[model samples]
Target: MQNLRRFILKYHFIILFILLEVISILLLANSQRFHRNRMVNTTNDVVGKVYEWSSEVGNYFRLNSANKQLAEENAMLRQQLSVVYDTTTCTYDIIKGDTLYKYIPAQVVNNSTNQVNNYIIINKGAKDGIERDMSVISTDGIVGVVTDVSRHYASIMSLLHSKSVVGVRFKNNQEIAGLKWQTNNYRYGMVEDIPTHIVLQKGDTIVTSSHSNIFPEDLMVGTVEEFYPTAVDALNKAKIRYATDFSTLRHVYVIKDLHKPELDSLKARLQ
Candidate 1:
C-alpha cells in the first residue's frame, strides 16, 4: 500500500497533465464550430474507409460463387443465340408461322461424368414440355440429351460418359464424325470415323452435325487438339478438347425441336 501511494505521488503531475490535455481538446471542439466540424468529418472518413475495406474483403471471398453465376447466365445467353432467327437471312416469306426456336433453361441439380455411363439431372420435367431425346447444352458447348423425365425433373446423358455419342462435324470442312468421351479424360473426347482425306489442323472448331434431329446443326462442341490417322484403315481419329469444363458446370438449357416428332414419324413410315 505504501509503495502504491509512493508511485501515484511520483506520476500524479504527468497524469494530471494528460487528463487536462484531453479535456482542453474536448472543450475546443465543443466551443468552436470549425473544430467540431473538422473532428466529425475526420471520424466519418476513417469509419467509411474501414467499412469499404471490409466490404472489399467480403466480395473477394465470394468471387468463386459469383463466377459460377456468371457462367450460368452466359449459358442462357448462348442458348438464346442458337435459336434466334434472323429475318434478313430468311429465304422464304412466311404468312402466319410461330417461332421455330425454343429453349428451356434449367439448373444442374445433379451431375456425374466419371462413370462409364454418366448422367445429369435438371430442374425441369414433363410438365414443362421437356421430353426424351431433347438436346442439352451449356454456354461453352454441348452437354447431353434428356434421357428420362418426371413431373418436375429430368435426367440427361452427359457427353463425358463412354456410352454417350453424338454426331459432330468440323466447321471448316463438312467432315462428320461421332464424338465420344473415354472414361480417362473428362476434359476431352475422341472424334471417330473421320476419313484421312479430310485434312485437319490443331485448334479447328468442331460442331454438331445436321444428320440427326436430336440436336440442331452448328451447335459448338469443342476444338481439335490432336489428330492421328489409323494404321490400317483410312479413318482418322482426332482428339477434341471440349469447350465445356465439366468440373465447374452449373446451368444448362434444354432444347425442344418442335418439328422433331413430325420428322421422326415421317422417317419411321419411310423405313
Candidate 2:
C-alpha cells in the first residue's frame, strides 16, 4: 500500500492533467452542437466498421453449410425438371406415375482431370443411397457415372475416361451418336457414328438419349465444335466442347433410376 501511494503521488500531476483533458473534451462535446454531431458521427463510423467486420467473419464460417444446402436444393429442382413435358393442348405438366429418378447431392472430395481416365470421389456412399452405374451430373451438364461405392464414399468414372461412352443425340435432329473421350483433350470429346448425311452446324447441342436407362433422356452432354467426314463415306465424326469443366468441379448429383433394377433383372435372364 505504501509503495502504491508513493507511485501515485509521483505521477499525481500527470494523472490530473489527463483526467482534466478528458473532462474538458467531454464538456466541449456536450456544450457545442457541432462537436456533439462530430462525436456521434465518429462513434457511428467505428461501430459500423466493427459490425461489418464481424458479419464478414460470420459469413466465412457459413460457406460450407451454405454449399451443402444449395446442393440439396438443386437435387430437388432437378428431380422436378426431369419429367416436365407438354400436354396435348400444349400445356406443360410433370409426367404421370411415380418419380422415375431421384437425385442425391454430393460434394467432390477428390478429383483428377489431367489423367487418361479421370475419376472423382464424392463424400457420399452406399449409406447415402449411392450405387454403381448411377449417373452423375453437375449444374453445367453430365459429369460421369458412379462405378464403385462403399459405406461412406463413392467413386466416379468421369466422362473424360477413354472407355466412357455415352449415348447422345443432336438436340435439333434427334440423330443418335456415341460420345467418347479420345484421351488427349480435357475440354473436348469425340462423337462417333453420326450419319454423314445429317448436317451439323457449329455449336449444335448434343444430349443424352432415351436409349439408355443410366441417364435421363436429353440431359446436356456438350455442343458440337466441329465435324469431319470419316474415311467411311456413310459416317462422320465430331469434336464437341464438353459442358462440364472438370478442372473446377466441386458438387455433383447422383441419379437413381427407380426401374433400373427391374431392367437389370430382365436382362439377366437373357444372359
Candidate 3:
C-alpha cells in the first residue's frame, strides 16, 4: 500500500494529464459524427485483431490432437478398403469374408533418415498388436517394418536403412525386383535386379509385390526417376523417388496380417 501511494504521488501529474487527454478525446469523438465513427471502427478493429490472435493460438495447440484423430480415421478407412480383404471363394467366385490385414494407427515419436540403419519409433507397441516383421506405412506409401516392441512402444526398421530392401514390382508389367537404399539420400533409393529386357521408363510406378509376406501386394512404394544397367549383370537398376518422405514423417499404420500365424506355421513345417 505504501509503494502504491508513493508511485501515485510521483506520477500524479503525468497520470492526470493522460486522463485529461483521454477525456478530451472521448468528448470530441462523441460530439462529432465523423470522430465517433472512426473511434468505433478503431475499437472494432482492435477487438477483431485480438480475437483472431486468440483463435489462432487455440488452433495451434489443438493441431497435434486433430492430426492424431485424422490418422486414426485414415486407419479405419484403409481397413475398409477391398484391397485389405480377400474376395476369393473356393470356386474362384467373389466373396468378402476373408480379412487379410488390419491397420493399427500409430504416431511417430522418433525417426532418423541420415544413418546406415535408420530406425523409427512409434507410439503403439506389443499391447497394440505391433509385432516383428509387421509392415509400417503412411497413407501415401510404405514406411518400414516393425523390429522391436515394448508394451507401449515399437521400433521400426526404416526403408532408408542401408540393409533394408522391399520387394517391389512395376505396376504396369509386374516385374519384380528389390529396392535398396545405399545412396545415403533419404529422398531417393535404388531398385536393382530389374531385367534389362523389361523396358523401363521415368515416372513408372512401383508397388509392393506378393513375394513379400510383410507388406500387402500392390501397396505403393515409389516412382522410377532414372534407370540404368548394372556393370555385373544384364539386370538394370533404377533410382526412385520414395513415396514416403522420411525426413518429415509423422503418422504411420502398422499392418497386421490376420493369417500370419498360419502362414508362419506352414513355412516352419517346410523348413
Candidate 4:
C-alpha cells in the first residue's frame, strides 16, 4: 500500500494534466456552436464510410446468384431466336383479318427416344386448348402429335417411333410421300412412295404436306440424306435427316387449328 501511494504521488502532476485537457475540450465544444457542429460532421463522415464498405461486401457475396439468373435469361432468348428465324413454320401476324396461324408455347416434362413406341409428355393440356392430334413442334423443326390429354398435361406420339407416320413433300418440287422412322436410326427416317420421275438432290429440304390437317403446309421435316431407286418398281425411296435434335429438346410449341374440325367434317362427307 505504501509503494502504491508513492507511485501515485510521483505521477500526480501528469494525471492532473490529462484530466484538465479533457475538460477544456468538452467546455470548448459545448460553449461554441461552431465547434459542436464540427464534431457532429466528423462523426457522420466516419459512419458514412463504414456503411459504404459494408454494402460493397454484401454485393460481392451475391455475385454468383446474379450470374446464374443472367445465364438462364440468355438461354431463353436463344430459343426464341430459333423460333423467329425458322423457315419451316409460319408465325402469327395478328393483323385485322388474318386467322390462319395460332401457336401455344409449352415445355416438355418427359421425353423418350429410345423406345419403340416413344412418347413425349408436355405441360399443356385441355386447359390450354390442347387436344388429340394437335401438332407439336420445336423452334428448329417438327416434334410429334398430341395423342392424349388431361386437365394440365398431354402425351405425344414422338416422330421417332416406328408406328408414327407423317405425310411430307419436297420443298423444291412439291413431290409428296409418307415419312416413317425405321427404328434403327434415330437421326434419319424413310420417305417412301415418291415417284421415280421427280428429280432429287442431296440436302434438299422436305416439309410437311398440306394434304393432311395434322400439320400445316411447309413445316420443315428434314433434309434428304440419301436416296435409292426401287429394284422392281418405278418408285424412289430416300432417307431424311431431321432438323431437330430429339435428344436435347426442352421447349416446344403445341399447334391448334381452330378450323381443324370443320375441315375434317368436309373431308368425311366427300369420302
TM-score of each: 0.66, 0.66, 0.67, 0.64
Across residues 1-271, which tens digit of lDDT does each residue of candidate 1 receive?
A: 9999999899999989999999999876563432111233344345435544554565566679858877777777667655765544655544336655588887765666676667776667778998878899987789988876666667777887656778998999888889888788788899888987887899999999998567889999999999887778878899999998787666688998877767789989998
TM-score of 3: 0.67
Q: Which residue pairs does candidate 3 place in steric collision? A: none
Alpha carbon deviation, residue 136, candidate 2 (Å):
0.5
Candidate 4 residues 70-154, lDDT tens each?
4775688768867766534756453435376568987666677786667777666678988778898887789998876766667
Tell me how far candidate 1 lies from the true structure as C-alpha RMSD in angstroms.
22.5
Error at 142, model 3, angstroms: 0.4
Tens-digit per-residue lDDT, 60-83, candidate 2 = 666886578577867877667655
Deviation from native of the Cα of residue 179 in model 4, angstroms: 0.4
> How does model 4 score by TM-score?
0.64
Task: After the best TM-score superposition of candidate 1, give how far the Cα of residue 142 lies from its true spot, in angstroms.
Answer: 0.7
Whole-model Cα lDDT per candidate? Answer: 0.77, 0.79, 0.78, 0.76
Error of 4 at 89 (Å): 26
